[model samples]
Target: MTTRVRDDTWVWALAGLALGLFGLGFVVRWQCTRGACALGRHEWLFDLDAVGSLPRLFTTSLFLAATVVAVRVAARSAGRRRLWWAAIAVVGVGLVFAKLVSAHSVVEGLDGRGLTLLVGTVATVVGLPVLARLGRAWGVPGARAVVLSLAVYAVAALGLDQVTGLAAGLDPSPLPDAAATFVEELGEALAALGVLAVVVRRLPHPAER
Candidate 1:
């Protein structure tokens, strides 16, 4: 019971932290958009679209941490369980690189919508079933929650973002560009943090192992 409580505490704490960080970015963005705050030289720190912004860094760090935890878990696992964690770790690493390099721009540069659709379709058709089988074999706690979080992240960051861009090109978008960017970036960061929390919860303490 105590261990369960502790695990729940960690999950809630990480969720709060993710929201708090997003709130801070939103406030800064609102102030800057209103010409109320003098961003001066540190504007990048508050700009959600910037590559090395605070939000981006936090998100990248979360992915890296998740990867580390997955690697550790894999090291102690065997057979299909090890493969499951190893696959998750690889995905985490890809996410970290994607965040750091702003991979969306590259995707957009190359037939954006088409590429996204193709990749999303392939992932849904191929990746989901494979991962589902591995997940059932491993029986990792909180796997469903983590997958749901990733789904939300993909919708906000990939789907909505492209739609927003297309709308902006066609006419004056109902959703303000800044607001859309803020939501996309915040969704991604929160999702990454969620994945990290679940992975951490499943990783046993050194003493336990």
Candidate 2:
């Protein structure tokens, strides 16, 4: 990772995107909530009609563009194999659906939770095999590091709510909900970058091994 950061331009791009999301999403969140209560994004957007769609549309566009670039790179080297093509369709649809969800917005009630869980489960099922292959394309050390970074990202993005809910049920302490929210947003950016990194890391393909 260290050497790749210096040698590869994509690494720099990924790093920049990660930092940009952290600065934009995380910093605003901290300012609004002061690292205290969770500010539900859909609720906030529900009231503030003017400023909500701008950021989500903008960020989603950027992420989709990055995904296209990664897919292009992979296709160039590996060709459009089954996993490659299927992964693209799955992730592309997922991102589009995510964007639609953001634009339409959903109240985080029981219905919303069920919807979100369903979407998340489907995405996880489709994405895991592709992501696993990408991680292992790197050798053991690089693969391990990439997978770990992605794990941090996954936990922060996907499982944080469940973990926090359990914690709250067990002990109603002041959960840094604000902080967790920012981490979740930041993790999305980082996770996307991690996928890009795996693609353009200049490592040998699995077949080469």
Candidate 3:
């Protein structure tokens, strides 16, 4: 009972820390945008849209941590289960790189809309069944939460971003551009943290198999 309580506490604490960092990043962004600081001097650090910004670094850290945990989980498993964990680790590494490099902007420059559609279709057609199998094989604490967080991350990083771009191109968007960026970035960090929290919770002790 005590162990379970401690595990829950750790998850909540990590979640809170992730939210706190996100809020601080947003505040800095808001201040910089409103002329409180020299925009050119601080934009690289505070701008949510900037590559390698604080928020970007934070998101990357979360993904990297999740990837490490996935690798650890893979090391302890075998057969199809090991393959699933290995795939997740690979995706997590890709996410870390994407966050650091602002890969989405590069994609947008090269027929991003069509590419996103193609990728989304393939993911849905292939990913769902694989996920179903993984869920059965995963059998770890917080597996559902990890899966759900990944879904949320995909929606925010992909779907919401495309909508934001489309709205900006077509008309006045209901969401301010900065606000949309904030939500998207925050959602991504939160989702990554969510996955990390679950994996950390489920990670076996060093003494365990």
lDDT of each: 0.72, 0.48, 0.70
| Candidate 2 residue runs with Cα over 4 Å from true position | 1-6, 9-17, 33-62, 70-83, 96-100, 103-115, 130-156, 163-175, 202-209
- Report the CA-based lDDT of candidate 2 relative to the real structure: 0.48
| Error in Å for residue 66 of model 2 | 3.9
Ranking by TM-score: 1, 3, 2
Q: Score every model by TM-score.
A: 0.79, 0.53, 0.78
Ranking the candidates on lDDT from highest down gives 1, 3, 2
Clashing pairs in 1: none
Clash tally for model 2: 0
**Model 1: residues with Cα > 4 Å off, grouped in runs:** 1-4, 10-13, 27-37, 137-149, 166-175, 205-209
- lDDT by residue (149-204, candidate 3, tens digit) is 67767766676677667656765443355566677777777777777876776576
TM-score of model number 2: 0.53
Tens digit of per-residue lDDT, candidate 1, span 1-209: 23644436766676677677767777777677666668776867967767888878878888899899989988877677777878888888888898899886677678866786677657655865577666876785556665655566666566666765765576543336566666777777776777787777677666654
Instruction: For model 3, give the 10-residue run with minimal summed lDDT.
Output: 1-10
